[model samples]
Target: MPSLPKPRLRRPARGRGSAVAHAPEPETPNVEVVEHDGLRWVNIVQPRQVDRAWLEEHFAFHPLDYEDVFSRNQRPKVDEYEDYLFVVLHFPAFDKQVGRLNAAEVDVFVGPDFVITLPNQPIQPLEYLFTQAQQRDDVRASLFGKGAGYLLYKIVDDCVDASFPMLRKIGNKLERLEEDIFEGRSGEIVRDLSNAKQEIINFRKIVRPQRSALADLERTKRYIPDDLDIYFDDINDASERIWDMLENFKEVVEGLESTNESVLSHQLNDVLRVLTAFSAVMLPLTFVASIFGMNVHVPGQDSITAFWIVIAFMVGLLGGMFYLFRRRGWL
Candidate 1:
């Protein structure tokens, strides 16, 4: 069987000062560079102001783009410029404090000879891709051989693809909650559903705008050269697939929530019906006792047998009312 053709990254001229072939040389402890076939992949795990200054010194990125590198809350977007393309994209990172998935921003600068990744927080797939490029020569040859546009494709594509497992998790949770609903675990299921719903909402927020941003990425000028839309198109399709799953999950959770509410309401009604029937039975018995306790002369009030008679009457009335309730299926 034939292997699939890898998308192309523009191969710049192997100019003077290019790093040795297949070596992932580090510019600093935090900044790592992988050079192959005249392309450089510079990855900074979390960029600081000093790193920002280094970038300004090394590259001619616009000041606004530099500011964007430090901004964690920038929405998914793409800014095309004459010299480079500045892209902002979000991927999911589970926050332990919030107990759900949240968007993590990855800011990218793609140029003719280099692709720089600045993630505001750690993303596993991004880290893995960079690590593989660092440790493996074949990995570098295949990835960095493509120009900056194609490298950008790889980063966004991997990050977008990573979301599928998370989607499956959300789907699995919804499935489990559906089963637990029937097992009469309304309390626990309610909380689980809420968490799952929140995760889905967070995931939707990440993917919804990203779809358009990816489309915008495709239209932006090729930084390394022209012709890499196929790669970005693949990323867009993946984003759309994630959005589709979120839509289905939104519907499923809503349905489950409505079903849960109905189950709760039905259980409440059963308890209320029983209480109402018991209260109805107690009303007459209370009236008879009140009359007997009055200071005014009452029939047979002075008789010794009155006490036993009242007790017998009360028991009879209780049994009668209980039987009536059972007959009506209100018990």
Candidate 2:
């Protein structure tokens, strides 16, 4: 294979007194090239903002793939062309205000000699991978030295690994919610659990289809190298693990919701029990007072001691009812 061309460097000044040579023009800021061992990787971030004419002029990619580029909300899939493979993968992107994960789309065009990447959202893992590839020759060699197939593997692997941190954050949030529920601080826990459950569902929506896409890539022909098949398998395994974790999270959130309902029901039942006991004790006293308040002449109506006698009789009746309730274990 022929060696790759070196970057154009400006000639240095001939002598100390000579004027400094003009610096070479910089490449487009949005476009980055990583080259090693005759392999080339071109990564374009946020291609929507870049001029469409530039993409049309540069690469002889399939018309359908280019059309897919302009299209929005494409499902996770891999389409094989004669000369390259077009892959659309969605990764989890968290929304802080909504407290949920959203799908972030990444389009990858993998050809025999080169790979092109365009991402719709700011993917931190991809950014870090590019930075490392730029700064470290070892990283560049390990990634760019291989064919486009292996480079795609690296990108998908990084994307899959990115979810682990977010999963940890959600796991911690769940633990805190469980603690709050048990401590009688469950007022806001219902809302928090609902958000968590929705987040888990969002993760599932992104991960399950992504896992299928990776599985398809593993079986894809022509563009994918034979030896690199195992690497894609590893990526598929990671995606499957993510899906399983999401399922577990959904179950936990459901359990939390059930526990919250039980706790609330028990609390309400206790309140109703206390109210019933108060009403039962007050019923007879109310009846006795009504009798005394009547206009009809009854026994001991003329004696001043009648009022005291009735009061003592009501107090004794209240004590007897309390004793009966205690004996029945209703209080």
Per residue, candidate 2 scores C-alpha lDDT tens digits across 66-99 of 7777788789899988777889999999877775
Q: Give the TM-score of candidate 2.
A: 0.88
Question: Please, what is the whole-model Cα lDDT of each candidate in the order they appear?
Answer: 0.84, 0.82
**Candidate 2: global Cα-lDDT?**
0.82
How well does model 1 score by local distance difference test? Answer: 0.84
- Root mean square deviation (Cα) for candidate 2: 6.1
Q: After superposing candidate 2, which stretches have Cα over 4 Å from the reference?
A: 1-29
Which regions in candidate 1 have their CA more than 4 angstroms from the true location?
A: 1-29, 224-227, 302-313
Clashes of each: 3, 0
What TM-score does model 1 achieve against the real structure?
A: 0.83
- Per-residue error for 99 in candidate 1, Å, reads 2.7
Error of 2 at 116 (Å): 0.7
Residue pairs in collision within model 2: none
Cα deviation at 186, candidate 2, in Å, is: 1.6
